[model samples]
Target: MDVQSGLPRCSRHPDVETGIRCTRCEQPVCPSCMIPASVGFQCPDCVRGGSGTGHAPGANQPRTLVGGRLRTDGRAVTKVLMAVNLALFLAVHTAGDRLVDRLDLIGHAYYPVLGEVVGVAEGEWYRLFTSMFLHQDLVHFLFNMMGLWVIGGIVEPELGRGRFAALSLLSGLSGSALVYLLAPPNQPSLGASGMVYGLLGAWAVLARYRRSDMRPVVVFLGLNLLITFTRPDISWEAHVGGLVAGVLLTAAMVYAPRARRELVQYGACALVLLSVLGMVLVRTAVLL
Candidate 1:
């Protein structure tokens, strides 16, 4: 078979030679032209070689492989959380006190009449989820949103979007449950602070597991817990409950499935949930 004469043989195209050489690689190319890249036309061979391109000679590489992949793009999550908090703040402020009051009806409550936190409480016990999206005041909203932005950025990428969201909801519900059990009647609380604290708690736990330093996180948590205790208006119950829940949930998520490591996490979360439920039942019985 006169393979060379049958088709204009290009050095690169062994099967079907064409009278073309890659502009970049200067290698013979067949009917298929080189793939165009930012720099120039890269022949199939060059392209394949480039696929495994490592860091530039002097460029620094991560010590761990997971470091690069686990690094999260938390900007989107931060923006959305910020916008929601800001919008709620504006709505509460512009709509006037009555509107705010009405909205607070739907907020998570531990009791039938006293736990008004955010939205209209109908029969939807699921307001625990909705209450998370609501905020009481500008200061309250901004503070929580700020924490969300900061912590969400760190945690979302590590835990992934779905798990991060689940943790937030669970933390918030746990906080509200505590408030319902421990706080006085007619005391209203609303905001994402509980969830924020939860994230912090989760981070602390996760950091411990990943062999990352937890001192800074622990200091921050301690300071916040102190503030909650000192400040009369702040619900310590919610903060403590949420914080505990966050740590437990984080442990459950990060270490639970690996051997028997999750046993501690599972036990911790179960105990907290059951304790909160028991408290709620006791409160209800006493009130009734």
Candidate 2:
């Protein structure tokens, strides 16, 4: 009896045929060789590649499942991020002042008592996360979300959701932190611009790390930075901080040892988050 037809033989284990394809590399794998992951099955080789998969020779191997679902073979995460931003924009507009006020209360607001941190100086510190969900106005929201839609669509599918999420959260927090540290005492800031900038930075780094042509990223980043500095109402602090942090964090993750890169990336993000929190605390103390 040919077992290969009944159960796909594990590419790694000749004796074992579990009929499972690695969600990452799509290599036939046995249950014993299959490694369970947050998104889906990942073989040992794919797991070891980490963010460096695109650079690996065989990394392009077809994926059977991703994030525990049948592969759509499209930029699902990018589409979702864009949809969320658009939906939130409509909600904020439709809800009007009521939504803004509510978001201000729970979202990141300029609070002298809380200083520059997202939720740290105030009980609503959760705003660090929530603020990313809110936008200052329609134009502001649309522009930032559009950037995310474009850059995220390009990067998320390549980097995967976990890395993309980390980039978004860290960039958002970093942007907030910059505003907290550098903005006027009573000034308040909110938007997804910081995260968008972070995505730009990440893509720039990814291009270099993967040795891909970076002309597009460089052109885009340069144009945005120019706009950021020239625009009077723009939160330049958030843009600068998030961009810098994104670059640094991406560098740390890209250059670090593969076995330890994820840990380092998480640690780097945590440190930035804490730094933002600390800035808020100091500001609160100074005001008090």
Candidate number with greatest lDDT: 2
Residue 63, candidate 1: Cα error in Å is: 18
Cα deviation of 255, candidate 1, in Å? 1.1
lDDT of each: 0.62, 0.68
In the range 142-249, model 1's lDDT, one tens digit per residue, is 688778888887777666555566677678778877776666645666677778889889878877877888789888888888889888777777787788889877
Considering only N, C-alpha and C atoms within 3 Å, which residue pairs clash in candidate 1? 103-118, 104-118, 105-119, 106-119, 106-120, 107-117, 107-118, 107-119, 256-262
The C-alpha local distance difference test score for the whole of candidate 1 amounts to 0.62
For model 2, which pairs clash?
Answer: 39-67, 39-68, 114-121, 116-180, 119-125
Q: Which candidate has the top score in TM-score?
A: 2
How much does candidate 1 score in TM-score? 0.62
Error of 2 at 245 (Å): 2.2
- Superposed by TM-score, candidate 1 places the C-alpha of residue 169 at a distance from the truth, in angstroms, of 0.8
Please list the residue runs of candidate 2 whose C-alpha ends up more than 4 Å from where it truly belongs after superposition.
1-74, 105-120
